[model samples]
Target chain A: MSVSHPPGVHEPGILVLEVPGDLAAIEGVVDHVVEHCAPARLDRRRLLFNFRVGLTEAISNAILYGNAGDPDRRVLLELRAVPGEVRVRVSDQGGGFDPESVPDPRLPENLTLPDGRGVFLMRELMDEVRFNRAGNTVTLILREPGPAGAKIPEAVISTLEDFRTQLGLTLVAWTLAGERRVRVFPGGKVGGADAPEDPRPGSDAHGIAGTRRFRVPVGAGLAVEVEVAGHAAESPVARVLAAAVERSASLAREANRNRAALEAALEANRHIRLDMARERLSREMELAHDLQMKLLPPIPRLARVDAAARVVPAKSVGGDFYQVIQLSGGRVGVMIGDVSGHGFPAALIMALVMSAAAIYAEQGAAPAKVLEYVDRAIGDELESTEMYLSLCYCMLSPGFPDIAYANAGHPHAFVIGAGGEHRRLPATDPPMGIGAAPYGQSRIRWKPGEDLLLLFTDGLSDTLARTRRMSGEQQVLKTVEENRQRPSGEILGRLFELCDRATPSIPSDDRTAIVLRTR
Target chain B: MSFNMRRFGEVTLIEVAGQLIVGNRQELKRMILAEVEAGTRRFVVDFALTGYIDSSGLGILVSLSKKIREVGGRLRLASLNEDLRTLFELTKLDTLFEICSSREEALAE
Candidate 1:
């Protein structure tokens, strides 16, 4: 079949080949592409290298997988060439498999699998890889890249070459391409990128002691040594030559120093930006911390239930917040939460959750519904910030024997019995902002005058003690077990006291806890 | 902080010096990302000359590793000092990267 041409093919157009679905066709395609690509150019050489491998893999898959080893099948491979880039498309006639269903090759179990690594390699090697909805056609893009010091101009070096030609100099030596040292005569020729071609005449090992050479600092880790014949360092012509070379080198050195100084200034500016961001965050956190502290509802005076909560941040602000809201129909709602991170952002989130939860929980909303509302409200922010919060909110009403609660990844919620037997209020959903799974509500048996409900944040349980060890959740449970018979607020107070005594060092985090009991 | 780069076959060996802290994390990130954009697929970050690293530096490495992996490149680390070694272990990031004790091991085929 004849090669086809597509619209927008620039002069010296793209390459199209219709090759039979045979493995033998690979060598022919590689050779044809190499011939058409400009291998002499430095940037294009890099592009060619990447294209060779990516195209090989893509065409191999198209032939083997798409054609299913049928020699009669034809694979359509199209290569579109642009300035400093190449786009290739490979299509075949076959049913497609879901790319998503492909197992991760990095997993230990899949590591031994040989057949599935082709697509992974292609995606990794190429700059861009995309597939059509049908999944049979794959398009890949590759770009050219110049080396680190490619920005230095050729005009700057031509002046030295002109001076050398005028003086009948021996050779000019300089570092080129940020990789290799090059020596060139007054002879006019551009050095290739790969390596210095046509080495300058009489360029053998010459020590700098004997040669009347002028050392020129080219900066960016480069230096040029200009040596002349038939001239002493003190000669009038040689003196003039050395002055010119030194002046140029000094100018280049100044330029190089300015560049380094500019980079350093940029670095300093970045640090200043970072410091400013941090300072602004801390300042805002202090304000939000104060506001959130004020937003905390004082323990409600209820005839049927008694509740008390306290939150203390290790820094000026923290992620821990609590809500004690009086709901309609003689019901009482208690909530405690810990955002994933601390300081300004977490404090802001806590403040938002505090205000939103207060409004929703006081409207007699169900525990699950209140959590769902909060999740929806904060889901975008949580997703953007890549953080999540743990929450345990419960509703207790008069004559209702069970307390309905929704636990969103909160670990430290419990109901302690009069005999010091405590039961964990199980987590009913993945943490808010983690999963789309609906908030689940579960009820536990609640008894008046016989049971106490307790909730605490991880900062309390995770506090480091004198042992340089974490004061674990087990410690909190033990503390509550020791003081299960005490009133709700007194239990909280003693818990704080125990935390203070266990202070092996400074508390590195915020601590918040809530306790509730029926009168 | 400063970086020096050398090439061996498909891998670009980077020699990092000074402390990799918040002060220079962005510069480190830019250099690495520039290479990735330039089609360098394999990198070995040699930390033998490095003195210290904080959480910000660690965070930058993680981000760089993720971006490189997303583009089908691999980044290996070599010769971490005691402080860096402990920081990686403490943060459980030792599991996420391929860290070697010597340049030979990092460049192994």
Candidate 2:
């Protein structure tokens, strides 16, 4: 079905065409319209047609015939005028396929495939084929010629409309005058001398050409002798032609103004969207940081034990942890861990290790037993995951005077005491989560005036030059020896400060230290 | 951080000359793994020039060291920077394998 044009009026109007079920018929009708209407409005074009309804058929046919016309399938099409281009969209309602997976149809075997050519042809015809929502929605864009055909300003369009209406009324009066004179002087056609022949057709009651012809009365007289013989009035269809030319000028001005306004609006919208995205990202980052911070334990005050511990995180959220917890039976459970990596994953692993330690420590088991339990608890989870944590757990008691600790793939702990010597503790077992290795607690002895017991992470020692020389041990001992006279907190601070001085801005993991001064 | 590579036959000695941080780990891993795959398994990493080793970078080294050991080859480390040497000593990783005083000693071992 199609809407036809009204009679005798020289104004453009939209035509709507609808086709049902038949894909072939749809293409035929669209092709015919393009051929006929394109030329008619090719010059001095003032026609706009909207096809809101038939988009389904047009798109489906493109998918079916163009894409082998598979009958069970459906597609969608949309055509709209954007700022600089005319956009046509054709989206297939098929199981969405990756755009990258579609091989070039120009290849021999691919040429025969029914599904591929549709997209290729559409791509050739359209300026761009943008896929939205993982290839579910596709848009085809086409640009019009000459700056979207010049916008006529609203003020100019209104003025031109009023002038044309007045001119049309005057022309109607002239037509009536010519008809009356012809009827009254019917016999005088033979007697009166013939005036200069009016070359215009009889329908042209007022000879206004295709250009706007300004006619002004030169002298005051009963019959105004206005000169209309110049440039504008010389055309055959002068009156209507004059109105069209004036309308075109106004249109050009209006289109420019509209384009300018539309561009400004688009720019404003882009800025607003960008600002909103930045704000959302900032909020998400803050939340992640807060969650990481909450996962850490509060600094434990070991007043009875005379222990001073300090942890300095490299980033806003780091993976290092050092805690001294009061266990059952008047024993103290001391833990120091370095989760495998940094940032969010490391933070999460640290949290997990802390929770697991808390639960296992409640059992009042031996240090080796606690580690074995922790290994099993995080077994498959840590093995399959990319990030993991390394931990050290020690249970110190008054009866033992020394401590029994288990190391699961972490840097060894230290004892700085009366002997004025610093010694590295042994790892009794392999790192946690690497298929369980046996963990046995080793005993340590301390005498009176045993100044300090230091447990730390690797961040303090692993500098590039030191890592290469394998001299981190020597450096750490030297730093400890130099700062032995300082307070426990100052000693820990000096250790990190020494690390920083050695490496400058380079970070060596997360700095964690727990020092106990024997009173 | 700057990375320096010295190829001695198939044994590639990588001397990392700067601070080792989290951001450069991926690039470091890519280079090291690519070398490993190219049949240069006998490696002597000279961290003497490196100023620091973060947890992320250390993890990469540990994983790489295990990978090399699995393939019937060894990753010998020598001349650790001041801070890193302390980490190795504190971690007791200094005792787990052969740690030499210089690149020549590491290669000789």
Candidate 3:
């Protein structure tokens, strides 16, 4: 059905929300209604809660059963408010059904079914509920505390009426105008100037003889004053009325303070929500970091090679990985690689490369062929992420005097000879995913017992430069040359010590290092 | 890092200083992208004073280089200190763009 807006009817508090028929949109609608009630003078806790639940049920029914989850269909929620009452109408664009035909959901047989209960709950909870003639629209009306638009609360009026009946008070009323006093009770005015301008709770003579008067401040210039025509100022009935006026004023002051406190608490809740989101992000980063650390292979004690590797993650996860695989031919495969980028996305790509590299190296594939296999495996992933991985792999056989290696654009792979002479491995091919050119293998001389091989990622270079103010590659060469005769484990441990010394107070980028000493 | 741009003949020289990482890298991307969109494409990025750069920063430079190249323009890198050179080499990014030893070398070409 086509919707229409009748002009010239200016509602005091009107809200209209048009939402697609989706259950996921329920929370947003509920929050909107709850917030709308605060300014509509339905801020009392009980009234707000009842209105929220009632509205939720009404909207959910309209969206679920009435609209049947159709995206093309719409649910209309309109809230029209007077001073003390809110009339809500939720209508759905669907074929109508008879309200009388709906089975009673509270009966024993139908109580277990979820589909038939929302309308029953909405009717029972709200002050008044009715379905339109088409049965596709639900109207819910709720009246908050106090009579419809009554200035003084219903309780205050009833209390004063009790006083009037017990001792026949002639006038009892309130006015918010601070500087001037106008009589506004008993449906008319009977003024005798203002109440004595005293902010205390006591009585004095009204304009009429034998009548008593009392007024008390109700916060921000509003006051409640009572006048009894037949009672004297100090009489028992006048004293009772005086106590009741004081009680009403005190309640008003408490209510104002509570409203302020509620506002403060709401602001605090908003900040807490923001802090929670930040904390959750940090926690996720840490989890990704730990996952990357766990992916590094533990160094195994082979017959002739002592191997060690270390990866230090930054405050956020970084994309660096290393693996030491003992192959089938008494030959060992050692690899160090870095994926471009940081954080979870980079770390995830690093993990994929690590697993693919391990599987290829385990099959005793040549270093060049291993890189080719890995490149083909993650080719699409690298292209999609706009990133690549640089790798340096070496296959060392204990009996052979040469190490067969492949360089895939990794710059920090080093080979130290027996006399402490260092050889910098050059890039044989571009980094993975950058060039389709094939990987190339080369051979470098090494002393089985006295020489060591060292490989590193760029974070090591950045770390040394940031902390030691020294050349990154040079510092690493000096460390390796000095400890050439040491076992691979000790050299790797010492390198980690240096890294800790460099960044003592803060976590640095992911720094990976591998030292291989073949005896 | 902050960028200071100047014109040298047909080329736009963007001199960058300070550390380049994820947070401030977008500013560099915005400045270069704005220029590239305005049809000024012959560019040289001088990183002599740049102390550090992270993966995100590197990613932007790589994407920017490709963008400039796709527009039928050439982008060059000049005056990279040893540290940045090592970074480029490690990631094998040194092959992606033309590198010159100094800004004077870049201008001469």
Candidate 4:
């Protein structure tokens, strides 16, 4: 089976045999044909099972059924063994029969009758089965299941076919695996021609009698051999075809390696893109958290008032803020706000509100007027981002009997008396984004030098709700009542200490509280 | 193709190896039918080592199932690989046979 030739010599690729039409010859003929097909390099299992069984079935049918057991008749077996496929044709001398008339053996009723399964087995095992119109000649084709690394792409095959035709070659073949050759003909047909010599020497035939062969090494353990009509072994056309085959083979090998490398690179790029996106999001949140913390104004020193405010930022940046501004005419303005959402958007809104409140409150405007000015400054920003803030502003003056205040849906603002009694300054309007301009103003009775004004956001209370038996606001008020006689800074410290001791069940929000007293 | 046969209580278990095709399906049919004739009421065909089966192999299994059912016997198949299981599902034969995931489960049934 190892038929090796000199570099430029022609080698036969077809085998034809004739056997007597007898069932006894079926096994010997099938084995002989299979041995001739070794150059195709099919896998061992497929060669031993599928090809052997399919060829045996075809030969047996040609002998027993096609010839009707006639000893004088002959059956011709023509085998073509190429690089990737093997084709075998079995033709008998007897009259043909219709292949469609065979019953399907898989049917339940036909399952018990085992004689009708030959055609089914042949069709199942072989890659392709074709019958001539007369039905006497049946060709079975078996293909090699090439591994992915050894497969030549379709574009390279077509390119080589173009070069073969242009060079007036009768045949061009390349060794694939072992002695198996991938043959390409002049008209783009592969493995169809059994003869390479041209008898007619005309314009189309290129005035040649026999084929002149040239071989060139293309890759590792691979060579391309081309056959042209007449004695053109050293002609310019032979050299051109040799160079083209060498160039195309190298390009094909490079393309296969590049395609695999490109796929791996694309897979790695996908993971890196996802990781970078997550990293960018966390970095932006940290920057927003820094900006929100730095935007809060410090409590100013005053001759008639003691004020302290504290804010604990959550893991995710939130928009809870407090401001204490000393106004003209010896009055102090205290403001606290909680934005509706958390993140950079809410932090931006909080910054804008604090800046606007400070600008208007320092001008000695009333509590309602300051809120109206702040709302006008940031109303469109809140509406566009679909967020709002709960704000409470109170004005405290020396020797005043009551505190003038404006509450916009701020529920935690209260005036606590020295005797542990508390009064809530309820909402005068809805929150900023939902409430219209000209915000309502009100006054709560205040005992100067005897009352403490406490304001905190919902985040402070929600953190304490998990560990306290009573409501979170009631716990805060009781702690404040117990420490009412201490300095404002100490009272604020105790409130935060109580919150830090309680365990939280959920993600915490920004906690802010302000304690102010006018003496 | 080859198979191993064992008796677990009243059940006869046959483990088929390699490919069960037209070349060796008759041996499997004969082995199962002979056991049924000997008054064996239960059988389990384990396919843990079998890789492939063709149409003729499927045909022989159907005929054996019919014969075993006439004798009031039960036939169960177990441990089919993914490709074999899909083949049975595509042929709509999964419903006709009681299939189990493991050989022990088939023997327990």
Candidate 5:
């Protein structure tokens, strides 16, 4: 290994290494070369990435295929690094292969092959890659990205130009550095010209009888001397010209200041508008969240039933809801549903669905009839919005051996036996929007005071499933089964505890679960 | 690389941790192939912990998918971060395998 710089240069811009033709030597050589290029000041991310992956692939290719793994063969690695750019070359002693014949690894047919990816990776990571005629040598290059600046607004420049033209001054000249003369006059044209010697104020110059000079100090060690020639010192026209010249200087300065203030105000206005939009969106979300929470009928007081239900809305309000209604014939109607998407749209649909379901269920309608009426009310709105919801409604009457229920593609409804066994009440129809009228209903054998009715949305299960090895639904069922002997409220609490403990990998959804035990 | 394998009903979930580069990609291939030989027909490769993968690592996945398909098995990828998802899409391999948002959905399918 040898590291050297040009004879007189202080920085090491060149490096050379002799690598043995072995796979084990690749990492060491690549690392050394990468370390050498650190002073080039390339972007840290690209520097670490492009060089590490590109050089590794290049050197490994040189040893394995170029040298054919011969013990005596040697590979040469060279690095030339300068500020904002880097170049690397790797050469082997063996005869070369055809670079054009390498098959693309991304092709579907070749995707399963594992050995043809080195060259492809090098090409992808490096900005440029080239091969020598013999194919035994390859060069890689990377350059620092140039700055991307925003374009200047043309309005400011044009406005200043227009203001200059309005001044209507003639023979206005500025002597910069006491040598270069910039002439601006008559038709708003400006150009450089050789200037005569300085003229004293109030002196006649250029053979004019009453040539008056006024010197205006611009910042930055420069001044503009406005000469009003061919006019008397005290004439009205001469006085007007002098005042215009004086005002032009101060006006120009004030214009610059005003432009800056204008830009700042524009920027601040943009931010204020953005803040107002954000505030409005959050307010609307809060309103929807409040409405959804308030609409949930408190678990209706029942004489022979222990009913408990909870709905945990996500950060963005989701359409998860549960309604427990008291019926006239001493029956309780339990409804749990999950609208497909989130935000105000889902909230609106949820509100409509809850109102419709409540009206029908409170009238002592059967489970199937209640779902039919709710779906009919929201069918057009769901179709227009292209959204759907899964819903399940169950009617439990005391002293009945079976519970009559209607399920619309809601998969979490289950009957848990006192002994910890459970059975699914399968969907009687597709989801509300997609399924047709005359919703089918089903009956499950209910053991009063012994069995527990468990209903939940996908949010509860999805959240629990994120960290657990088992499906989220299974975990919920297991939790319920273990706590079946406890009060329904306690069982619901345990289920929520499991949900709160699991760390969800994805954005959480609204969770709603209902556990009711009828005696 | 670290892998956590758990069975959710019939679907086998494998959680890949850390970078799956050239050095550690073979271990994942061997693990999945062995499971396939053991008659595990459904699989979900969860990438919630994985941060990076090189081309060679992708090659092993492709080959493993091919091998799994020969035995009438299915492979699904879940929880890929934005960069990893872009890699699969760029390689056009996202179309070859089932890509799901969450492991729950993947296992259910």
Candidate 6:
């Protein structure tokens, strides 16, 4: 449908554009308004173009950043058309910002930062502005016809003059369309309002990082407030502009929230579709995880051997894994892997690596050959998919006392004897994903009753403390040496405990570890 | 060392809190300067309350101390927190000023 403007509109044309508070809808509104106005009004010298850009900005900002993409907010837009002017008012349903306290985005260093430019841009675009007390409603005025002149209302002028005695120096400027210029003139400071404090030279007031007020004269005898307060300009002006801005924001938010509630209510029946999608994904992940987990043998029910394993995926699904398999030939195969990063993709890659390792192991492949196959398969897949995984695999012979293993970017495995002698089985190759590194194996014969073998992902040793000084493999060895007297499971647990104690609050990568000991 | 305060008359303690970060630091500096110009320099700053501080806060604090000292008075800080006190010790301001356990102790010193 075409936009309809009523008759009797004067020199400046005013059109109101309304859109939902959703980011997509607000953006559509911006495009629609810009498309309608930019071309047609090129010839019009004095036109009043107003619609709720500021309000839309506030509501959409709340939708995108504040609520973090929650679809429950409703926004309303009200457009008022006057002679040579258009005012767009947007109100949101969400809680509003405190106008006096927004962080300054225009500070010298903040000019290039990614945040805090929205309000400043909004203020620059509108000719005259008003903000509500709660900082929700914002009224933005645009003069399509360009500014007519300093038309500050006599009442406001007089009020300002009454308060001018309080300010030592008041500089006012007209912030016209497409400009950021403030000039010093012959006029003295107007007196009226109570002065908070006179900013001294070399003080924050004198710097380019604080607030300064100015006046803009729009067409048809309307003079709007302009602030050039250095860095503080955005917040206090946003406060004054909040009256108009907040209303628009409130209206927009209310509309969006109501829309969301309706959609959510409808979702009671509609959730079948979402559930269907979720179930499909869950099915794939469950199958993948099950298959991968099966490759890991359940605890060998041997009374003599002390063995345990743990894996915590960083997501609903994860790439970091630990597995122990009871081979058909009466041997045990143990492996640990870390996919390049945490996510479903990584989990998927890890699953592939696990399957390849299992297939190789089932064929009676040696520790080195199994790793070579897994690495080749994983490296090929990573190359094809542009992703990578780190893997470590081991084969334990009942006849041979030492554990045999190969590391592909995985940390070294630790071995602790019953009497506290500790040693690390070091791998001789780079990570599997590097493509060119050939997997190599190392074997150590176990001493009679060498009771504990620890296999772990890097998560245990890769902590903030070890991040700079040494590699996780080195830390693992150090920790193992320190805790050699502990049981295999206890050693792994204590290693993680030590790292956790060092950097308690740091968000760590996923952690996984497996312990196997000859009885 | 990071934050210092002194009493001019009685009961007017000027305490500085947090890092007076760059760009916005002039405000804090001016506040102190204004009070100094107004001749109300008597201050008992509890630095123990400050968790962190930066160069600007340090510059302002030192400048205020110098300003007050030139005016025949001083600024004293009480109950310095561990980190700030460590910073003071590192900066060697621990020797330039009196160290006290509490605001009352600083006042007495």
Query: How high is the lDDT of residue A430 in model 3?
Result: 90
Top model by TM-score, which number?
Answer: 1
- Which fraction of the native contacts appears in each prediction? 0.00, 0.00, 0.00, 0.04, 0.20, 0.00
Which candidate, 2 or 6, has the higher lDDT? Answer: 2
lDDT of 5 by residue, A416-505 (tens): 998999999999999998887899999999999899999999989988786778999999999999999999999999999888888543
Error of 5 at A174 (Å): 50
Chain A TM-score of candidate 3 vs. true chain A: 0.48
lDDT of 2 by residue, A284-378 (tens): 43464577666667656654466667665553345788777777666678888886644344566677778878788867778888877777776
In angstroms, give how far residue A146 of model 4 lies from its true place.
40
- Give one digit per residue, the lDDT tens place, for model 3 in A202-249: 333332243456554443324556666776657787777767766875
* DockQ (model 1, Cα): 0.03
Every candidate's chain B TM-score: 0.94, 0.89, 0.93, 0.96, 0.95, 0.73
The alpha-carbon RMSD over the true interface for every model, in angstroms, is 17.5, 28.2, 25.8, 5.9, 3.4, 17.9
Q: lDDT for every model? A: 0.67, 0.53, 0.69, 0.74, 0.72, 0.53
Docking quality category of candidate 2 according to DockQ thresholds: incorrect
Model 2, C-alpha of B100: deviation from truth (Å): 38
Residue A341, candidate 3: C-alpha displacement in angstroms:
2.2
For candidate 4, the share of real interface contacts preserved is 0.04
Error of 3 at A308 (Å): 1.4
The parts of candidate 3 lying over 4 Å away from their true place are: A1-271, B1-109
- Cα lDDT tens digits for candidate 6, A468-509: 577766666667667766676787687777666766753345
Model 2 off-target regions past 4 Å? A1-283, A435-438, A463-473, A500-508, B1-109
RMSD of 6: 19.1
- Candidate 5 clashing pairs, residues 3+ apart or interchain: none
TM-score of each: 0.48, 0.40, 0.44, 0.42, 0.44, 0.38
Winner by lDDT between candidate 4 and candidate 3: 4
Error of 4 at A443 (Å): 0.2
Where does model 1 exceed 4 Å of error?
Answer: A1-285, A464-471, A504-506, B1-109
Candidate 4 residue spans exceeding 4 A from truth: A1-268, A504-507, B1-109
